[model samples]
Target: MRKRILGALFSYSVIGLITLGLIEGILQLVQLQSIRSIEIARKLYQLSSREEYLGRYCHSYIWKSNFIQAYGQHREDFLSSSGLHVPHKTRGWTTKPNVTVEVGEKQYTTNNRGHRSQKDYQEDERKYSVLIVGDSYTFGSDADDSYAWTNLLQQKDERLQVINLAVGGYGIDQMYVTLKEEIDSYNPDLVMVAYISDDVFRLKYDFRDYKKPTLQVKGGNLEIENTPIGGIEETHQEIKAELQKEDIAILKLDDLLFNLKISCRYPPYSLFSKVMGQMQLLAWEESAQFLAVYLASGAEVEEKSHESRGEEVFQRWAEENEIETLNTRPYFLQGSGYQGGHYQQAEATIVSDTVYDKIMDLESWKKFVETNR
Candidate 1:
């Protein structure tokens, strides 16, 4: 009886193994295994730091999704070769003055002051000027220089001398510093500060590919650190030098948790959100005719379900300070076909028109111009 039971158990185990092999074979035949393997690899890729996540994660997944990409992104050539930006001592980086580069199919040209304007800025004849500051969205990422919302705003009225002081990948602290440095020289009748969601959390990081200045609040007072960490290559070398001497146990439990995707929605980030709000408010207090505007992209809504924590903070502070604020969420994907990413020419037009309408109709923006002009 013991021998018979042992034989039966062995037969059942063999059958189960055969069944599992058959299922795996079916999956392989359907190409599901390959697809799932790619998906799993992409997820693992996303678990890396943001720099690696952005610069690396999208390659395979994007290529798979957009089969149109025979090779990776063609625009990489323009991005790498474009000597359109120069390192700055205090502000981190700024657009190079008087540069004309062909990005993809479009020609992007900067004025003598390094702004991507259709024509040079005429300071003497300016009647009403708007100084717009922020990161790539404000810098008109992926859009032609002539079509960028700032330039479009200038086209809205001949008198509106709009200056675009936005650089790609700038954080809130950098924006504040840029505004402080340029506000007096630009002397605009109205100042528009544009920010996307990441600008808030970016305040916490000292390095992003290139080293940058960052800010922290201690005992309710703001403090700055890591200013002018050198240019891109220099910063890369500096980080490499530090990493070379790094301890083996640097990846703590908290670092592991941070690596998880859920950490972005964790409560601690909420505290950073509040701090970011306060930082923007402080910056606003420094400018005379400043209006905070949140640029919403279709990609943000598709990727994250919640409204940006930074936007919430900004709206609350704007209410308390009675500062003019605009959320461009509605403008996104409305007849623009802006699926995600930097705006195309049509989307840029819509955004510029929407902002122009807000300036004309919104009481806060109008009041600021009237009072400050």
Candidate 2:
């Protein structure tokens, strides 16, 4: 009886190994076939043979090497030595407070609150303050502090106190977090959420340039992920762990089965819409008027266009939510307003003028300005 039991166990073990081997073989075969198909498609359709298009699976070592090459420095050095940007427990990274850094002809100066301003925020009861939150365009990247649209807007009117809380490289998720965390302190009369279409697509990644908070839609509500975001070393370890778990054959199979696109997956619009809704709700809770400003990118300005799928979705979402929106594309298209993939001084002027006009057109803004003045 003992001998018979041992024989049965041995047979089962052998069968299990054989099944696994067969599965691996099938996966490899499928991968090979997929690569051949990609090659044929590239030749026939004139598609570029990019690594993403070819579905070249990067192993753990290769991925790490690629990351190092992309950054051009050790992770620690990159994170610690990144000028003006210090790691934040919640927002990922924010500008160092009361610090100024000069790069070429551009000067980046942060006030006491870490915003891109020269003056510390002092709430004035007599003035109607407009709080601006968004990414680099709103933060005025590649432009001087005085040339930023936020500053220009402030200069346009003395009754308006424009407070810019924008940070470079922030996604809508981070912007929402910033607004939630900072709005009550300012308690401004109006809150303007400005963004470009690319900012929406940034929702698809947990890390861009560095670690960041990501959001998801759960049961019609937005849920924050990666809370108390890890430090540089921790983030690096997490990324390494993720890469180590990669199953090349399985990854290849997934790429082939899904015919995955070259870029990161399209931005999750449901999540995006939910986040915007939450922002609107937050503003309502604080009794502050909320406005969405869609800034144009260099490409959009060059094309003289305003409509992208992301922008269209956002417009529809705003309409459904009864949220007011201002699109700056038309204003940007009126002249050569872009440079180096960001808004030049001319574009900043255009944005300020357009936004000022939009604010003047709003009844709530008019009433707020009147009451405060």
Candidate 3:
């Protein structure tokens, strides 16, 4: 009886191993095919063969090879070569101060304060200062310095001094941190926090292109983690070592077959809500009127039902919190359209018009103008 039991156990173990091996082999073959397809696409479209560009193609794949090839390589080249963004101790990365870079026909210039502007910010008591914080959309990714909506909005009203503190690839968490750190110094009468649906998902990544600070919910409050983020190479080494500790064969198989979308343990919206609350508190403490601006991407603009879950939750939360919100989707739809997933010149003009109108219509702005007059 004992011999039979041991034999059966050995046979079952062998069967399980064989099954796993077969799955692993299949996954390897599928990944190879996927890579071939990606290469064809790259060649056909003249897509960049840069590691970062290829990494975007690998994002949907779960093979270990895909992850290994792309990990920490996605934005490293751009960050190093562009000289626009540099490592930050607290925020993980920030825009390099007073640098100018031209891409295609568009020129990006950063002021000494590290904000995207042609000129440095000088405190003008006569003007109502507006501080804007957000990701690439608010940063005006593809738009030239003169054509960005912030600059356009400023051109509309002489009484307004608009200062954009937005950085590309920033999550709402980073925006909050920036607002807290810079608000008192700028002493803006109005603060605008602009975000797209994708920015909320970015909250889940502690490491995207390079290391970044992540946020967590603790006892109904927000806690920041992964602070003083390491350099690209350091972060790469840590991730590699950690992955190496796991059973590579099983990990690859599980990732490929099971499709475990285990990016973050916490739901993104929970942290998002906490960050938004904290931002509101900070703005109030600084005596600034806070506004949340929602900008829709081309996908959301085209498909009405495809509005992001993050945006829905945010709208509800804002209403409940009595936080004023602006949806810029209508303005975008009314304009020419988005270009390369960003606002084109005409759409930017629409944004500027909408925001200027919103500000003028604000009771706070009215009171401020009245008081100043």
The numbered model that scores best in lDDT is 2
Report the poorest 10 consecutive residues by lDDT, candidate 2: 41-50
TM-score of each: 0.69, 0.80, 0.80
lDDT of each residue in 172-276, candidate 1, tens digit only = 778877776776676565677788876765665554424567665667665666775575456445555554454223333222233443344322444444444
Q: Give the alpha carbon lDDT tens digit for every residue of 333-357 in model 3.
A: 6544455377767777877888888
Kindly give the number of clashing pairs for every candidate.
0, 0, 0
Model 1 lDDT-worst window of ten: 59-68
Using TM-score as the measure, which candidate wins? 2
With a 3 Å backbone cut-off (N, CA, C), the pairs that clash in candidate 1 are none
Scored against the true structure, residue 99 in model 3 reaches a CA lDDT of: 90
lDDT at residue 239 of model 1 (Cα atoms): 57
Clashing pairs in 2: none
lDDT of each: 0.63, 0.74, 0.73
Model 1 Cα shift for residue 58 (angstroms): 13
* C-alpha lDDT (0 to 100) for residue 130 of candidate 1: 74
